[model samples]
Target chain A: AQRVTQPEKLLSVFKGAPVELKCNYSYSGSPELFWYVQYSRQRLQLLLRHISRESIKGFTADLNKGETSFHLKKPFAQEEDSAMYYCALFNDYKLSFGAGTTVTVRA
Target chain B: NAGVTQTPKFRVLKTGQSMTLLCAQDMNHEYMYWYRQDPGMGLRLIHYSVGEGTTAKGEVPDGYNVSRLKKQNFLLGLESAAPSQTSVYFCASSSPGTSKNNEQFFGPGTRLTVL
Candidate 1:
């Protein structure tokens, strides 16, 4: 079965600190990975995709096939960066998502 | 463009009641999806449509029904509401293929609570 796992349920980081949210996925075939974010009172939206290889909002996720991971990383955390992040995998024309990690950047 | 829009931003229902959540997209996307978000359980796909008049069961389709009679609209119906079904429902639409389709534009979401 194809599944995405985000080990952290709640992650707290101090402002200006480096933050990393772990995401691991299991799939039988080549995978396309993505990161989706939802901020308070805002609609869920795409943060980045592995195919694009581009960073969004100062965050970047590298798809590591050898380790079956696609972890999201940010060098400096900001209060505005606090939000829910979901790692997803495109499987058989559908996207499978992880349980999500909520990041809270403390002032 | 409105992108994706879901009706009834907030709804409350008693057990056994029925309701339909409407999703409309102006992007002319060929794919539409319905998902429920619960604490600790991210977004679970309830139902999706690849195109008009073609609906498919997703990761979690039980107790839910979907229709995509119109290309721009997708409807999710809960035959009999249950407390277990209480969650925030989101609607999204995407174009076909693997490249640009990776981006699924989402609606503001509907918060459904069943007592």
Candidate 2:
């Protein structure tokens, strides 16, 4: 079975600091990875995909096959970056999502 | 475009009551899905429709029924509501089976509580 794991349930960082949300997956075959975000009082939206290889909102995730991880990272965290982040794995036509990590940026 | 929309943004039902959640998409997507969101459980797929008039069971399909009578609308019905069914329901749509990568578009979600 395919599974997505996001170890941290909540992460806190000061504004302007670097942020990293750990995500790991276990799948039998090559997998497609994605990062989804949900801001306060807003619907969940796609943040980025590994296949696109593009960065969104200063956040980027690189699929590390050797480590079985696709951690989301940002150089400088902003107050607006505080939101819930979910890592997902696409298997055929279905998607498996992680438990999600809530990032809190404080001044 | 509204993208994906779910009806009855909020609802509270007594046990044994029945209701249906409607999801509509204007993007002409071929794939539609219903999922329940719970704390520490993430999103669990309840039912899905690959195309018009086609419905399939997902990871957690028990106690739920779904239908896709039209190309743009998918309905998820709970015949008898239970306390365990209380969760935020999300509807998503994507153009898959034809597109290389399936990027799903999500709805605002419906908050359902069964007491």
Candidate 3:
């Protein structure tokens, strides 16, 4: 079975402050990880993937095989960054998502 | 493209009532999925289809049924709705291949409440 854990249900940060959303995973093989985000009144959308190693909205995540973790981070939090974030693992043509973390960027 | 569209943005069903939720994707994605999101819980897969005419159960498939009669459409059914079944349902679709990295496109979601 594949599992994704976000550990934190909510994270509050001041504008311009750094933000980190913790995520951990359990899988037997080489894994694929992704971060998905859902803004208020919007549908869920992909934030970034470990494979692409690309940053979206100033956020990035590095897949750490040794630690079995893929934590999302951003140097500066923006009010627009407030949304629900989910860590997901792909296996057997399906995605296993974490419970999710709701970020609140207070001004 | 419309991406993915789900019918009946909101619904209320009585206990023991039956209903079907429809999802359609115009992206020509080969894979489609159904998931339910409960309060304070992650989205749990209920059923999925890799292609038309094929359906497979997911982690929480005990109380749901699914069919993919058309490549562009997938339907989820509830033979008997229960209060516990009240939640938001989301449908997603993706095409496989290409470095094994394709993000699923999600619908707006359907809010269901069972009394």
Please report the candidate that would top DockQ against the real structure.
1
Off by over 4 Å in 3: none
The TM-scores of all predictions, comma-separated, are 0.98, 0.97, 0.98
Tell me the lDDT of model 2 at A92.
66
How well does model 1 score by local distance difference test? 0.94
Model 2, CA-based lDDT: 0.93
Q: Between candidates 2 and 3, name the one with more favorable lDDT.
A: 3
Those runs of model 2 whose alpha carbons end farther than 4 Å from true positions after fitting are: B97-100
Candidate 2 fraction of reference contacts recovered: 0.66
With a 3 Å backbone cut-off (N, CA, C), the pairs that clash in candidate 2 are none
Write the residue-wise lDDT of candidate 2 on B42-63 in tens digits.
Answer: 8888988889999999989998
- Model 1 regions lying over 4 Å from their true place: none
TM-score of chain B of each: 0.96, 0.96, 0.96
Candidate rank order under lDDT: 3, 1, 2
Error of 3 at B98 (Å): 3.6
Cα-based lDDT for every prediction: 0.94, 0.93, 0.94
